[model samples]
Target chain A: MAVYTEVPDDELAAFVKAYDIGEVVSFKGIAEGVENSNYLLATTKARFILTLYEKRVNRDDLPFFLGLLEHLSAKGLTCPQPVAGRDGEALRMLCGRPAALVTFLDGVSVRRPTARHCAELGRALAELHETGKGFALRRPNALSVSGWRPMAEAAKGRSQAVSPELDAIVAAELDHLEATFARLDLPKGVIHADLFPNNVFFLGDRLSGLIDFYFACDDAFAYDVAICLNAWCFEPDQSFNVTKGRALLSAYHATRPLEPDEVAALPTLARGAAIRFLLTRLVDWLDTPAGALVKKLDPLEYLKKLRFHQQANDATAFGWRP
Target chain B: MAVYTEVPDDELAAFVKAYDIGEVVSFKGIAEGVENSNYLLATTKARFILTLYEKRVNRDDLPFFLGLLEHLSAKGLTCPQPVAGRDGEALRMLCGRPAALVTFLDGVSVRRPTARHCAELGRALAELHETGKGFALRRPNALSVSGWRPMAEAAKGRSQAVSPELDAIVAAELDHLEATFARLDLPKGVIHADLFPNNVFFLGDRLSGLIDFYFACDDAFAYDVAICLNAWCFEPDQSFNVTKGRALLSAYHATRPLEPDEVAALPTLARGAAIRFLLTRLVDWLDTPAGALVKKLDPLEYLKKLRFHQQANDATAFGWRP
Candidate 1:
């Protein structure tokens, strides 16, 4: 729930004049994206999402994100297409922040995703990966294997405040992941690093759109699959739901068959995914200021996930026999 | 920005199935209305607002609020009419909170309201009061003159922490207001006690609709006028803008002529209005738990407004003469 920048009425009117979207009928700040201020903008022409990119998003990466959306939408993938203004620029400035108007996608995000939702998500992920192959831009996943050690170091002494065993567990996992990640030469492509259920929208059982590409980067495609395994296949009690995992994996495999190496590396990649989230969530837990606007998710949730991944012997543990 | 209650998809689907609004195409939690969890629910038929009443709103008062919207909208006042379900009930349960779906009104809320906007607001306020006359419900203003003392007492010692002079000013104002309020016998009716800029929507320069009637009650109509004077006719620096006040008062008088006594009582009522907000905001400032989801509005802003109102003489001071 973020609307950090308040766009003045006259300023917003002026901003809308640049677009061909007609007179603003209704504009409302929506509790959608966390990384940016998102307004559900309705004009005489159509509905669009006006996003003011917050400080958390790197300005240098805006082009890559915008370009990827444009590329994906052009390739017939279901995503928000960046709408260009009369000046033919998709990105502009609003209230001193980098802003863009993207076509509004119609769908509701499922809170408790079922096996069908998981299957739909799996197919969408594979389609995204396949379509992303020909995209021109390349961005390294900053939260990938190489990034885990720095995040762990940042939360070193403070992580114990969240849990007594968190600090040691995180350190061991970082060392293990860092040593093993380089050797696992898995399929690499554009990966939606944070394709949580909240980011995937569904029209009943059908996946209508995927959103929040701020975390999209060039990484092992199977790693994206692993992220999904952690995000979509986990029960509220932190137990892995093999039924959901099998549904997700089977649907994904049917769309884009997983490489033999990619399948074999799933357990290690899943472990890395767990540690990545744990470290980031731990850092957020340690650093979030008291009385801050944003809610800090429990790091222990990811810690429980990490524990499960640590014990897994092969992809079979994830309900996928490779 | 509040979406405290997360509506699960299947539950929401089931909930929407009860309504005749067609299949749900999209539903997004909107960053509007702090008192309730508001979602912009778009279906195959039309767009509507799905509001889950939070704990802050009294469940007992839900009928009056919903009924008032129904009555007002029925009387041709442009507002969100509560959409009744197949059971003919507008009020129902969702996530254990009293919930209702209302026809979505279209318009944008102005961040910085102009004199024209103030005039439109004035006419609309009068229309609301006129239409609310025959409504078969009564809710006494809970934050009126009689209610100030209790709220002030709740924030007694803590008031000074917000400002050095707040305690003394609040105490003195309470004494002054208690003595003066009963003497000023003014026109009484249903009043929109909270008509701040955010609660009123505009299409270009036209007043589109009035909303958030949680504070609506049976009170002095002029006091409601005073609330608008304090809300819409004030500059950001807390200075009273007479031009805007004149526009607002004149437009309101054109729609519903103010009685001589009601006109004469504007100064005291405006002072009362200012103190009413100051006390409530101060209480919220004092009682809000640290790290709570809602943002605590600064009581100092209302403190400044109260000081301005205390110095005013009569309706003439508000750019209207009895």
Candidate 2:
């Protein structure tokens, strides 16, 4: 739940006047994006999302993010389109922070995703990758292979407190993934690196929209698939849901068929995805004090998933028989 | 920023089935009301607020609160009306907590309210009090003068930690208020005891709606005005803005004239109002641990307001000639 900055009424009214949208009807601080402050802005014309970028998001990267959304929306993906002001600029300053208004999409995010939802997500992921071709901007994934070791080193001392075996397991996995992960030649494009279930919205069984493109960057399309497989195929008990994995992969394959090289790299990339989240969560858990408002997520949850990926060396183990 | 309960998609869909409003098009948890979990639920018909009552609000008082809004709306006051489900029941269970849906009002709450806004708020407040008449159900004001002593006692030990002169000031003021607070005969009706600037919404100096009725109860209407004077008439520096006070009072009087006794009792009521907020804030300040997510308000701010009201012994001090 994030509403880091409070936008005053007079400032907001003046800010909205820059755009051609009608006078503000209703505005509310919404608990949406975690990295910035978001307000559900309703005007006489339409409803939109007004986001104030906080310190977590780099100001220089705003153009890339907004441009990608525009590019994807033009390419027929259901995503937020940045609404430019009368001055032809979407990014401006409001409340001493960079802000932008985007068209609001209508859909409710599913909490417990079914196999059908997974299939929809898979097809949507493929569509996003295919549509992302020829975008001028390029942002390398910051939390990729090069970012893992530094985070693991930072959380090394306190990882034992989270779990007795966490330090050993992370160290061993880091060595293995660094040598093998993402080594194969595969398709590269703009991948939504963090396509978790909460980021995907659904209306009944149909996928309605995908949101929170903050973590998107240029990475292997197959790596994005691996991230989704790690994120969507795990049950509450840390057991692998092979049916969901098969549905997700087959749907993606039907949209854009995966090469054999990409298929063989799934387990290693999946393990790398697990490490990426585990290290970040480990650092957060170590830094957050007890009784803090933001609940600290257990890093060991990903460790359990990592253990399964370590044993599954082939695509068949994930129910993806290409 | 309260979103305590996580209502799953299946539960929310099932819950909305009982209502005839339409299928949910979008749902986002909103950072509104402090006491309950509020979600901005947009459906095919129109937007509505889904409130899941948290533990702070008593379960037994739900009907009285909802009934008061119904009565006020029927009397033509702009407020959220409770939306009944198919069975004609407004309140139901969702995610193991008592919940209700209310029609959404379109307005923006002001951060720094001008004198004009205060005048508009005064008229709307008077309208609320007048409309509150003839309501069958009744609920007592729990945070009235009777509730002050216990709270002050709880914060007495930590009072010195907050300020060097805090304990003595509170003790003296409590004794004085115990004798004169709410003793005079005044017009009694349902009062919005927490008519702070944020609780009232506006669109270009016109009052669009009033909200957060959890604090509404049967009490002296003049006392409610005193709460507003304390809440709205003070500048950020804690100085009383007599101009704003005059605007608020005169506008309210124009809507529903105040009796002579009510005018005479304004000073004591305003002083008592200051103490009421001062004690509650003091208790919250002492109880909240450092580094908690919810920001703790400074009790000394209200102390400054109380000091100003202490010297203001007559209604003329508030710029009301009557």
Candidate 3:
């Protein structure tokens, strides 16, 4: 379940009724997250998803979560539009929890994303970020410099393999990251913090929609690009898939060419991004959920990935050959 | 906002009221996850984290997360133990969510962990895994084998960075990972799936506590070691931290020596671990929470990390002299 909150069916029905969409047909629980409770709903008008505000989600932030989608969608980005309630509100109380209904996207999440796909996503994401500047709400970065250290604190132990040199390297890198990226000139805007493959829906070879805007917040635009380079261009062995990297960057560049400063900051930002996930995932891994099909993600994977970024010397390494 | 959940204060009070150790304090959210909602509470007698089973939390699998902590704690591993409710059940219910309160650890997470810290973590993890055998429960490795393909599928079109050359390399590496590690001799047991820095807490120079055991599952023990090499032993720029790496591996070995096969598989396993995180994180990045504090992590860093591992011909690359 991506949503950890529990909302009864009847309450969900009432919640949907508040929305201006047509009619509700059926709704059932679709457990697919290690965090929240998500349900797929088929309305007479269209299919939609109903996410209950779960434990991993704060009820107070529902407006940002729901409003961001609405804001982005309004700006012409193809994303889920949150349904407002009877009082012209996007949020509603369901089963004693905060919940909302969103338009169900039609395209399937691409499994075989191509260079073209990456480029398209890059362009689309840049446009989204640019347009998001006009959004009615504002949110601070969720995984910025502040969050990284605390997460590292969470995964300090539980390692069965220890290497002194390894510790020194990470410490040095952290210092470098703190010092270097601290002063880089980069664009700051609303970024889709979690720009992974599964969140993007494609119609054929084209990116049809972007889903899951929960991590959207104000941060460096280059960070998003770096994140895309990492997410779209990496293979299962943690190696840089240059072909994919080039395509993603090219597409993004077409939309918004990266400034030299942003490009220069890529390596360090990349490390910071890797460390952010490694720490968070490690913390999450150590603490399992009571009942769910979610699996513990390996944090070390990001650790090694961070190491790779540290040694990278060429922009071409990320698959950009120009 | 650290904890994404709420364990009703009264329900938590009722559950803890029966505990033999101490007084029950109000339950409060801990707010530091993309998965579970954790709460820190004060009992008249002790401090504990009250976890409300979130959507991602499985009520049935409560034993694995809760039990492992107890088991590890029992064996002198510093970690939080699940507190049973008045009903003789480790799982409790509050506000319609399955809940349990775990012992509050008395240590802060280390910000600048040293090689000695890595070594201590390695020993503690090895001890935990070694003593975790023959537990009353079992869980399959969810992130193993079949998981990769699905992630690759989601990333296909978007992996523009994966040139044909890299694709071939990645494909070959995956095959090698399956074949090379297939027949390796190693002990299997419940291991901490995520051994990053934050999960383990420290009291000054010594290791004080480990928290968050959500991803603890049955798998190869050395995989945990490989995970550490990838996590605790790396510099931010992906450089190998020898001092910390040695300390970590040495400590782990002292507790549980590695088999030759496990040693041979170390590089590949480390690579595989990197890939695992790269894929999952990439997937998540694409589907970032619509309105949550969770940040989008970098995937490029891992890609670079994988490349380094691919070129790594010596254990010393990981800061290990052995």
Candidate 4:
């Protein structure tokens, strides 16, 4: 949501010269993508997104992320393809930051997801998983079940500042997830660990693209489904929209059938997903200074979702039929 | 750069439908223009800048701004033209803010202005004034000579915090300007009062376009030139580049010959122009909260420029020839 680094004009023109893309026509910093400074760079040829990887993102993960986009696009998934320069390198240094130019996809990200949008998202999510098989690169999900404890502990002292019961809720969820998460031996593969509504684009009812794959990593496939259910199936009033859940789940099932164990483990996976987001959002809420450029998303929103997931004892609660 | 408002997807789609442009292909919040939430809206037909006027901008003054763009574009200036909808209305409501779509111009703003860039900017500024000869609507410059004293007084109390000498300098400058600014009779017309380097664009060395007309108002044409000299002639080290000043004033004078009286008042107008920006920037520097999305510019930069202008008693100080 902010362009932290200001690329000099002559430097930009020189950098763009390395690529086969024609002369730079217009360049603008886009108020999009939280972790990186994204610019819409247009040339005589076409428009592309120029991303300067900020310090928050690990530079070592560049190959995996850039390669994954290349691999996914080759597999017929609609995603940004990294445009290699004349030197045959996709990732290079721009203003002392790891940078990449990606072909821009055209679509609008829905602010409020309809049931139809959810269904399209589910299909796309399943397709991403299906196509991401055998990528030959591995990155562990750093914010998964193994990472929740440290995150929660860091925010524990300051947790009560958000709400009186936030600390207790986080502690109990962490305990429950740590005991049950590793036990579930569901299908595992690469997943877009953060598939929020903002990450998926839609052209009317049709899903056009999936982006911000920096979070994509090896994880339980069903865990990604749980992430989506928590993300897209909830209304503004904090109630789960079962119709949206059905649309999302059914479409996903139609694309790639879920295993019996995966279906049975929905309640646990959903709760763990809730805790994953709750802890991170809580840390961010507590860490971000007041009046920072980036808008702090309320961690309590996930706390409310966690409360809802706590009572669901079966897949039926998520509109998943056997 | 920040996007203050988020336009919902459906609202954006319905809004674009009002115009004859095809369905929305892409919509992104642009981190450009401080007073408005600008989105780069792409349809099947073309790319356009959709500007939603935020609360900082006066809503009543919108007609004058939009109408001015239309008038300037009609006069063959390479400025953004306000695109009217099917109902022939360019200004309307979007997300409860006054909004209009203007054709997207192609160019990059030079971060470091060369003598060549300054020459191009001068020509473009002179062209804008010449083309704006008979623009019927008139909006008083709110940050001009008449507006400086109030702004200076607003920042006077806390001026010592910035520097012990700051308050005295502002006081002396304001007194000198108020005494002399009214005595000079100069050619007055519509002027792009805020023609900073960021407001002017270039494709390589060729001047492409000028934008951000929120500050355009009826004022002395030489005052606008003085504003440009203050903006474009200064180097990063706070030294005025006489070469750049010569290029700018020479090119501008070639376009619209400056009267001897107007040339003689360059030092005073330049001082007043420096005060205008210095006072407004001082207010912004003091008023903006820490960690705000909008970056606070250093007001002392203009203070240094004002000090330089204070010593210049003739146009020769600005590289003007008799």
Q: Candidate 4: TM-score?
A: 0.97
Residue-level lDDT tens digits of model 2 in B1-322: 7577878888999999999998899999998888799999989898999999999999999999999989989889999999999999999999989999999998998888889998998898889888988998888988888898888888877788899888889888888887888466678989989988888989878999999999889899999999999988889999989999999999999999989999999999998899988888899888888877675778888899998988996998887866
Higher-TM-score candidate among 1 and 3? 1
Can you tell me the CAPRI class of model 2?
A: high
Best by lDDT: 4
Model 2 off-target regions past 4 Å? Answer: none
Clash list (residue pairs), candidate 4: A291-B291
| Candidate 3 structure quality by residue, lDDT tens digits, B19-114 | 675654323334344476665555456656666767875676787778877777787777888777556687756677777777766544444467
Expressed as tens digits, the lDDT of each residue in A1-322 for candidate 1 is 6777878778999999998889988888888888888999998889999999999899999999999999999999999999999999999999999999999999989888899999999999999999999898899888877778888878888776888887787777777877887678877888889999989998879999999999999999999999999999999999999999999999999999999888888889998888888888888878888777677888888888988988888888988956
| CA-lDDT, candidates in order | 0.89, 0.90, 0.69, 0.91
Evaluate every candidate with DockQ and list the scores.
0.60, 0.81, 0.01, 0.77
Q: TM-score of every model?
A: 0.95, 0.98, 0.49, 0.97
Candidate 2, lDDT over the whole model? 0.90
- Name the 10 consecutive residues with the lowest summed lDDT in model 3 chain B: B24-33
Ranking the candidates on lDDT from highest down gives 4, 2, 1, 3
* Candidate 2 vs candidate 3, lDDT winner: 2
Each candidate structure's count of clashing pairs: 0, 0, 108, 1
